[model samples]
Target chain A: MTDRPENDHWLVRPTTIRLLWWVFCIVLALTVIAQFGFSVKGYFGVDGWIGFGAVFGFFACLVMVLVAKGLGLILKRGERYYDDGDSDV
Target chain B: MSEILSPALILFAAALLIGPARGHWRTAILLIAPLVTLWAVWQVPDGVIGTLSFLEYQIEPLEGSPLRRLFATIFALMAFGGGFYAFRHARWYELATAYAYAAGAIGVSFAGDFITLFVYWELMALFSTVVVWCGGTPAARSAGIRYAIMHLLGGVILMVGIVGVALQTGSVDIQPMLATDFSTWMVLIGILFNAAAPPISSWLADAYPESSPTGSVFISAFTTKAAVFALILIFPGEPVLIGVGLYMVMYGIIYALLENDVRRILAYSIVNQVGFMVCAVGIGTELALNGAAAHAFAHIIYKALLIMSAGVVIIRTGENKCTNLGGLFRTMPLTAVCGIVGALAISGFPLTSGFTTKTMISQAAATEGLVAVYFLLAAASAGVFLHAGIKFPWFVFFQRDSGLRPRDAPWNMAAAMVFFATLCILIGVFPEALYRFLPYPVTYQAYVAGKVIFYLQLLLFSGLAFFLLLPLMRRTRTISLDTDWLWRVVLLRIANAVSTVLLALGTKFATLASGLLGSLRSLSERYFGQLASEESGRRGVFARDWPIGVTALWIAVLLTAYVFIYYI
Candidate 1:
């Protein structure tokens, strides 16, 4: 905090962001549990499992991010990759 | 009026006026032409309204149907919005070609036969390439070429299919058909190419990001969605589109996730959004078709909004990468808010257009018992939130402060964005109005409690994951390779290698030919050298003054030898 630059927006401050993160985490957990508590119909029966949407979404996104990471290793190139005078398109 | 011109023709006519006109007159035409087209589009009744004799066949140039009108309406509306966005900033030629491009899309929408559709399709290809060239950069020049080549190839394939179908079926009428032959499959492949379907899908990402900011907006809304319209018309429920579309969806997400260029990310997600529409077309249920149409309508608005937002950034700061942008919200608050609205709409957030339109496609899948398809679509939905919905705004406007603040969009551009943003929310809130334009009757409800809760849980968790994974998701000054590598790199490399070898062989052949010529010249010299020397030395047989008696003696000896041989 001592060396931090001036940030007029409270949302971007370290302490405020930390608090928002906690709130977001709690709300997320509650929403997931609410699905089980409400006994909502789901496309698949597994969707009815407690916190299923949460688990699925989180894991799916996690896997997607990881896959993207792995892809970046092979696919990512310098910004000038296309400007190499040959691969213009 | 008894005489009704084609809505597309009206727009095309307007395009011609853009070139010669100047200043306020041009702007007036730019803004009014779409309204005129929209008016014309709605005037006709549901049937073939106009026809022309072409090549001994009666071609329906204008037809009215629920689907055709729906597509035409949206294309016209897109022309209006895109025109509004581009009028002040874009060069006259770009605006002209864009209007013509929109006209082509509108024409395709109303086309009742393959011949008409093919002509309009090529018209769009030609004009949109010109629009890409309006970017006026070396990159834009080359990208336009690649874009043109890919589209021309697709056009050729489609023409072949159309001819084959016409030969066998004896009509060019557009209708839903099975991919049961070489002809139909070729047709499918051709349409898929325009839809940015795989192996060739990279063209969309490769070329679009190179376009001018407003140019990209116009490009995004037309070509791929027109392909969707074509699919709905001719290849609905074709089953294979489901697989092709899912690949587009996932590929879009992964590539966007890895993309550094902000506009390219948006471009990738265009493929992703189009994937939803394509998937619904594959589903082929009444609700699904409605969903596809509705989604296309909705997607045009939101995607244009997003692209416009990115365009504003590009215009304001002259930067297109997330790594080079941040804290834009401070100065460009209006742009940021509109961008977030667009992002939410695209992510299917409740009370947004995307939520209302996209869920219908998923519901269609569930109804059809496409369990695998449904779940994968569900996962891709969250991925959408991850890649575009959140990733776009957070990186460009909210990430680490790049210490750059630029002014917001110009008034006209902002108004254009606001126009679309309002529509995104309005349609989400009152979807029945949009539904009324749908080809199929609307029976699906979007606000069911169970579905709402499920999507909330899913999208929210996806958002949560994005935050937690933000460290890994840092934007860099890099580009992600795509299928374009096949042609842009691999194929080009191969071509280069072949050219180099050919050059080597060419030099070798030239050397050998020259060497052989030299040797032949020397051989001739050998035979003629003595003759020349004899002539010069005055010792040549013909040149020498020999005694008559000596010559006669030699002739007699030669005659004696000949007589002896004859006697023997």
Candidate 2:
């Protein structure tokens, strides 16, 4: 097997940086839009709970990610965990 | 009318016989079993068959009503279709076990009493677990164990409630139970568990997807639908189910939105579809109950079609993750088209089975003046389109090409998908056929233009939301977290930790006790003549003659003391 060159690593790749920047911009846009949209809806005599729901949705997503990571630690067996062929057909 | 055989008996006998058979016999048994059962189901008369005495309860095995027969007929039909689909792919044992499982579901549908229902309920649990294990994978084994535990837990609760009802009411007849008794609540919880209600709903997604592709198709048809049938029979007007059902609808939408595996997404949506039925049962109007029944029938067809299409994809490409799949329409056009049909049906698009059946439930809510429920359900309809209708087909079949070319589905799988897709459209266009089979008379129409237009707008906008939110809904290489974490992670960890501590303590206690005995033996050897001989001392107190005699004497002395004290 041939050894990989240093430039072949993903972190230093130009494409990776470009992709990260795109993702960062998207997230920022979503956050801004969600905040403004909730406020505008609330101002127009829509339910004030809309603001609360928006905040709750953001946090819920965050918590879901964190909880999923924690759960993955406990429940993530090897890829082959369920692939053992010892079970009866 | 001609003499009718009992579907339940035929299925049970087939299950018993198929276990020992090899190649051709097994295939023949699998193919013929459902056909026989279907014929038997068709023969059920429109009345109660017979009742037996069980303790203080009367157990009715066969009850023929239009509603019961409707579900029974469809279930028998599903078994035939599913059996044909699996006959070529699944192992003989799997086919046999699945047949037995299908029988249990049909049995529950025809059951006239709680006792008969509970018996078949447990049977479905047992046989479905066997079907899961038939996947012949380690994951399948663990999943089967978890699946069995959850079902047995539900079955025990159901059994306890049945016994309680029998003891208090002195009857086990299956009828509308409106009482708020402990037994009634227990029965509700038991049924809810099977229905994939909150907290424990993860079992359906976790277990069913882990089954073999063919096995998953059969697994999709029963269990929860049986629970829906039970709910309609028992708790028709229970208002609490509305909230529970609403939660499931959103849960399915959100989780499926986040899912990666193709089959897992479908599994989550099953809970979502069943949620609509459960909510209708809560509404408890004739229209709502009819809606629930019609939805169940529609759901079985579309869901099976969806799973069957997914199964074909998995078999063809050996990939199930959407991230790893796309551009399959080019090669597997038939499967893709069938899958899209299923997706539309599931999304309640116009001229589909879901649109015809699911709308009645929402209409029922509106008529009942359940304003909040109606709005939430309407929004949930949008969410359903976002998650299942657009996302599923888009990501799996029409997304950026993954450049993996695979052949179309095999003849059997294609035929199954075609059959179900045809049923979905037929029911959608002519819902009267389905409506006539309801427990009540048909009076509702699903073809109103205003209603159809409203649904189209809501769902179409949801599709817009999906495309607009596409960046956020990108497929990640991760499994979504669900309530199964409680059992699969938390409870499992606790059990492991407790077992470890116990084992450590046990070993330490054993070692220390042996050491103490060794010292005592040495001391005894020095004092008493050769009683603690090397070979004899190592065997410990119970194994030694001196201690044995001493223990016998102590027991004898204690007995004598007890006798004297009592007598005096």
Candidate 3:
């Protein structure tokens, strides 16, 4: 294994990144809960329920990632897969 | 001598001059060609002009309307900007071919009849193939062939439809069509093929990234947008397009999310952006049509800008995968900045072109009570940000330093990016400049507070999801299979199997046939020899030794015997 580059970027420092994640989580939770107090006409009536966008966005991403991973399992191959002799047909 | 100069002809004619000219003259032609075309476009007043009778049919090669002009103007501007970007870096032939391709698009924009449009449609296919070949790699060559075949198929489908329409209506005039019959359905399928709609959508991602970086930028602007323009003209209000367009939008996002290549992500998003326009065309309201046209215009600029920035990265580092790129912001600050601006613009940040233009499409859906379409478009907006807006910049410029410090883009390329970036913001800030040119009069306002807030909320939350799922989004050295797999793998394997079986059967048949022929030859030779000996013994002399009279007598005797047998 090669040496990792020294972390000179302030934003990517381990502690700072963790802190940023925490702040993001707090903000996301607030936005989700804010749906209860807000009367914004949601695209679906259910969207106005607490944490809808958050739940929808997160689960959608999760499902997409999982589906992609499953697809990758079947479809993924070596970089030279198409360049190989068998594919020349 | 002519009343009006066809803008497409101007570009096409100028394209011929580019190859022969050298040094500064080439640059001058490159700069002036689009300018002249733009000027010619302006000269075309509303209604058909420059009609020429061909084969007893009046073909209007130059028709002017707000929509045609709008599409033509952007195409011309795209050629100029793309030319400027590619002038110094790209080979001369590539630029010439690209100009020819652009001319085809401009021609399609102004074509008043299906015949003229079909001719130019084919022209784009032919020249763009050369541009794809300009990538100068084996991958590019094969991909170019596939690209050509797909387009040829699309052209044939479109031709059949055009012919059917002409035969049905006895007029070849450009007009709206519903998919009420086989003819119109063929036409819709044809246009959708170019638009990179599903079942054939893989062609866009398969081919575009395989082109030379500049070629990809040039390609990003045309073909599909021209298809969008065609849809607006020929197949607007067709309900099926909404489903097709939405499929493309989601397909692009899902594919892009799973993609590892930097330029490829941008390539997928082109389909995504065109999806918005296609969906709006389906909506078929004045507002939706306007939104479609306006969104197409914005999409071209921003998408090209996005691709151009990625081109810079590809040029500088010579690495295209996200796995091989990162931390370019330190040294290639200018490229990073320009790329970020493009990213923001594409993400529909409040003051970006995408926000101004794409929002109109969603709003039209909302107003029409297309609740499902509205929600999905909203979700797609966030997905666009996830897959393209953030994913492109994050992985390429800011992920982790891959320890490659390459120089920023050359001055000319950077200048091109800056010019487009400026336009992205300018159009966003003052959309009226673009709105004035839309096919319909503008009445919708873009910057209401509630809409902005909801959009921000949706996008920001999606951003949060991206970060939360960052671990899952890491780039790898593998490619995701797409619909092309059917042709590339399954169909090819089947062909190979059939050919192998046919070869074996052919060889076996040849051997058996040869054996049977040998036996027949031997049997014939033996029988003939026996017959000759029997006839000679009866005559008691060879033919050479016998007199002519004797030979005649034998022949007559044989004939007499045969006649006797017949009588009996």
Per residue, candidate 3 scores C-alpha lDDT tens digits across B477-564 of: 8777888888988899999999999999999999999999988866765554335535443322232366889889999999999999
Deviating ranges (above 4 Å) for candidate 1: A1-7, A36-38, A85-89, B1-4, B522-568
- Candidate 3 docks at the CAPRI level of acceptable
Model 1 chain B weakest 10-residue run by lDDT: B533-542
Q: In model 3, what is the error at residue B197, expressed in angstroms?
A: 0.8
From the highest lDDT down, the ranking of the candidates is 1, 3, 2
Q: Which residue ranges in model 3 land beyond 4 Å of their true spot?
A: A1-11, A14-56, A85-89, B523-567
Give the Å error, residue B435, model 3.
1.4
Off by over 4 Å in 2: A1-89, B1-5, B16-32, B532-568
Please give each candidate's TM-score: 0.93, 0.81, 0.91
Each prediction's fraction of true contacts recovered: 0.71, 0.00, 0.28
- Candidate 3, residue A84: the lDDT equals 80
DockQ of each: 0.56, 0.04, 0.35
On the 0 to 100 scale, the lDDT of residue B529 in model 2 is 38
A1-89, model 2: which lDDT tens digit per residue? 11453344353356875796677556544544454443322211222332333333333333433443454454444333334411221
lDDT of 2: 0.80
- How do the residues B235-335 of candidate 1 rate in per-residue lDDT, one tens digit apiece? 98999889888999999999999998999999999999999888988889998899999999999999999999999999999999888898788889999
Model 1 has an lDDT value of 0.90
Worst 10 residues of 2 chain B by lDDT: B533-542
lDDT of 2 at B101: 93
Q: By DockQ, highest first, what's the ranking?
A: 1, 3, 2
